[model samples]
Target: MKKDRITTINKTAETIETDLLVYFAVEAKGKMPECDTAVHSQVKKAFELKDFSGKAAEQILFYPPARSKIAAARVLVLGTGPVNKEKDKGAALDMLREVGGEVAKVCASVKARDVVVCLPPPKHLSPALTDPEISAGALAEGIILGDYRFEKYKESTRKKTDYPGLDEIKFVCKDNLKIVHQGVEKAKNAAFAACTARDMANEPGNHWTSADFAAYAKQLAADTGLGYRCLEKKEMEQMGMGGILAVNQGSYVPARMVVLEYLPENRTETILLVGKGLTFDSGGISIKPSAGMEEMKYDMCGGAAVMCAMQAVALEKPDVGVVAIVPATDNMSGSRALHPGDIISHYNGVTSEVVNTDAEGRLILADALAWGIEHFKPACVLDAATLTGAVIIGLGHHYTGLVSNNNALAKAVEAAGSLAGEPVWRLPLNKNYEKQIESDVADIKNTGGKPAGTITAAAYLSKFVGKTPWAHLDIAGTAWEFTKKAYIPKGPSGTATRTFINLVRNWKPGKIK
Candidate 1:
């Protein structure tokens, strides 16, 4: 872990000395001094030179000190593609990580002990498709993430080589260092929570069960000052939580409903956050093929993000009341497994016909959302879930799909996503999509066929919201990535946790105008 602080250009450069000065090259163009001197001809010519454009390849150029001139020990220039085409915040941030990782590799190759990254002035850069703060935050985040090394299990490898660890990092910025620092701390905290969630979610099913997750939630509440409660199987049955009970029938581990609340001082409005906690999704009696069953471990990422977001909120003490509800269980196949066409009564007294056991996320979320509405009476509600592959097919892994009834609430979430550097794209929630979830056999159906699967899932959960301004974030595609990009790692991205925290921290009632 490295500690970083931003210093201005007005500050003395002698305050810190390093082995290299890395500069960002936009469209193969390097920065040049403004002075008109004959000896500067070489530097000017170098700036005018162009390099071949590659898909995502980076080109590094080193400039050594000239005679009698003590230039930086070394100058490393990084290519960032054509400036106009690379202005997308997410893409630009990804480039920064690639560049940073290359720098780290070069430093290790030469055994250089220290390095400093010049955070360029924001004025020199064009506005990213996302907000400016997010771009800056993503840059900082990428540097940190690029330096991550999972060497804990390295002892088993026989290959021997020297890989120097990064000791410190210094960020160079002109203004808003405090605000940037705040964002940095928020990102770090969110990352830590995500790592914890990933570890829990990635554990083997035998090791991590619904009961185990419930106990961990209780422990988190005890360690922190957040309120916590766990509802047992009998309690859920007593409360008419048939959705959870049906999902848990096949698993030996009992279903547990965990609720954690953070009440802020002088709070004016409350927000409810519901997360789908399918600890392991076996597709139940509608068992999925074995090809991608390994990915089932990540099914609980939605619950993890919710838990992590609440943890971050408690740590930051945002000025808004929040209730995080997680319905923890596993969807497995056994003699007791739920069969298609089974009618289950939910907590809100709405009956759902189980059309497909694989569509279990919405089933559990229904109970959690109803619990939030009936208990917290929040002004607004937001739920995140790895609900559908249809979402991934629609939006890919780049953005989380957002569906909401209230335009204001949806926009707020989108803005929060921007500020947190976790982007979201809103999807429509038209009445035609809502009608897809309607059931002829029961009050509603758990699966709405294939068309608009993501929207139908949102609509199904919306039934339990009970007039509260609500939004649904389907993060099935973004919650986890197979490859590293920008600030996110190859595993759990901690997708919407920071966005939710930002939304609550900056929330103001009736401020939409």
Candidate 2:
């Protein structure tokens, strides 16, 4: 992890000890913050020249003369657009995050190692968000996320600059020391969990295998006091998990089911998180096109998210009992690989006629969902998977496809996704779609048809959920992509880790009635 050392300081940026100083200046209205005469002169000169108006996404870079009173050499002023609306609250808060990411990109380009960020009190902003904690948290998220660079495969990271990427980031939040620390701590924990997920997702399929996932689960359990178990190929076969066995028959790496549980004393509700753990999806005998086949390593992002979410749950120690199940394997097209129209009898005796070998995520997920519900009897089940490209066609990259059986659970899932900056748009779960997956010789078909493909995929998983209030988050569109947008690099986004963590942390029982 190339993350910077994050700290909170009550002192102003001018007097802070760092290589660069960062400031927040609102668009068209922000007054220059109190600083030394030289810094003041620089700001005034920029305002006079009109070269650096405080517009949204705008930045002004200045270098103070040598031997100045301020300890910083370079100063970066970030622009925040007008933020006054109550309804656009999410957008406003996100602007702060955007500004933080912008500053981080600048610092990364310059290869600066340390910097001090000063959050100026914007007079035009609402008073409710004037609290130091909220702003500090948002900025920390951007700085940490933007500073990310998955350069592990690079031969050398050594550069000509004095330092590489950021090593330290000090946030000056004045007298609000306690709240600022609290916010920064929370952000740091969330970022740590999410970035860990990203790292796992970005790993090549060969490097991060089913056994590797089991190892990570054991480490997490050991570190966080969570109960962990790894059901190897023998155990899974003994338990009659046909879906997992069928998928792994093509791979030499073997299959494993990683189960992580965080139980608190006298917990009222249990929530099960099932993630599809296909480390690599080659579409089995029904092979995908050779193009873009390398990117199939991201097929395990769902498992990565669940693994990281369980880790976060352990750290937060939420009152609700949380159990995460990831049935991991690599789907390859060897001679013995599963062929089209194969019948897979899942853990719960639900047989699926696999029309397309590429639709393997739901097959593995069915086993975990069935086992998780029956063995744990969780109050609710939320299974996330990069299930289908139809979801990407429908929701694009901005939103995840959410389908659920119960209205109350659906509402809660949507709220959790929204709070975590991973919003989900609800799709219908009516019984009407169930018929699309009806099979001739099996209990159901792996895929329904071309029309409403996302809904039909959820319909197939719904069969194994039993009586639990279940929600399916098809994160196919949002998990990993090559697009470079703002703070998000061209790789895995750690899609649902924070949302799952938020759901567990804020979960309250008996409210669904």
Candidate 3:
């Protein structure tokens, strides 16, 4: 998919036959601007309509005159909602993407070859929020969000059915064309990396195990020329990674601690990213119910995000250095599985009482975090994990829960989230929650009380962070989606990959505001 930008809309613009996007907006009822008047009139007359007052997601096609010189066969009028509805900006942005995705789907069904998107003219934007900056932002987001398609596995089927695959998308923008193009390019690259990670994470457990995932990481590093190392169970045991060893006891496959490093030529500050890579979480001796156990394939989403983000960074080649640490293992149930009440020591030399074997994400993260703190000594560390169901209970799939010790780092990460289009909501990590993990038999219990479970989980990982500025992102709910919403397609959401890159790229030490 190639995206190009133009300065103005020319009705006589030479384009491909499948270029379907004819962008227009309703600033007021029955009023159309000069540039959009032709397209708007075509749509209105086709549907025998006076106005698009109450329509949403409505489609109107245009046919050029039999002897006309224009190239396009049809035009698509996307609903931008009413100009005076006090619109939800998020929803509006999402709608724009929805329009794109729907059009792509239509084109794919009909075997269309290419698309030309005539961007909504700046003058058609609502007066209340018509700033070019905001418009460009929304337009960029819409283009990327709309262009996404998860059809890798369906390519063969699609080909057999003669479905049209969109090969190119050209953007026709009047002003700020370069900025819009840059934003779209960045977003598309990030989205492509995320989609790769999401598909890998969504693969069945039998296909993506601890060892297999480590191999995949190594391949990514080799392909991108980033530093890569995988530590086996023996190596980890030598390093005293009891948390990972304990979790791997029941599985046939051994645990792996995979590390990928990206040190730019002009390195300055170091950022460490730790991800929980539970390839197939069967909950060990405390197994999860069979009802939704299939969803556990997504347990590795956090690790996948880290892996993909590292790949993106390597591709983008920012000045900062990045270290990606993923502790890969399968939490399974067997006679040899570690049971409840087992106490395991971590790399930090702190013991954890496994009250519930199902609470295993923190177990792997604990060892990874300790290793990161001890080895990398990073200026700031951010660990993303599908850590707690309690987060799902609190935020559903709308947002990832963020808990950080440094307010400055937290705000920076929040800003990163905004840029990545995966927003985070900061949750309290109060000392009261820390006490919940204080154990009678060990330094801390793996599971805290049911109340504030997510916060306590963050607190549990905090113990291993040492004094390094740290932030924990619990992405259990946000990592996978069963329904399509906004720019996110239904499946693995690739929640934090882009945000992680954005945060690291823009990070500044001792520059908290």
Best candidate (score: TM-score): 2
lDDT scores for all predictions? Answer: 0.72, 0.81, 0.75
Which lDDT tens digits does candidate 1 get at residues 321-411?
8889889999999899999999999999999999999999999999999887888888898999999999999999988999987989998
Per residue, candidate 2 scores C-alpha lDDT tens digits across 1-513 of: 343468887875677667788876555455543333435566567767876656766676777767766778788876665554544444555556667778888897666788888766645444445666666776787788777777667557655543346778888866678998877877777777888889998899878999999999998898889999988888888888999899888989989999999878889988999998999999998888999989899999999999998866887777899999999999998778888889989999888898998999998998899988999988899998999999999989988899998899888887777656678999997778999999998989898889999999999998998678999999989998623456677789998888898788678897554
RMSD of 1: 4.6
Q: Could you give me the TM-score of model 2 versus the true structure?
A: 0.94
Per model, state how many residue pairs clash.
0, 0, 4
lDDT of 3 by residue, 374-488 (tens): 8987888899999999988999887889999999889888878765657789999877999999999999999887999999999999999877889999999889872365456
Supply candidate 2's per-residue lDDT for 461: 90
List the lowest-lDDT window of 10 residues for candidate 2. 30-39
Worst 10-residue lDDT window for candidate 3 reads 5-14
In candidate 3 the C-alpha lDDT for residue 513 amounts to: 25
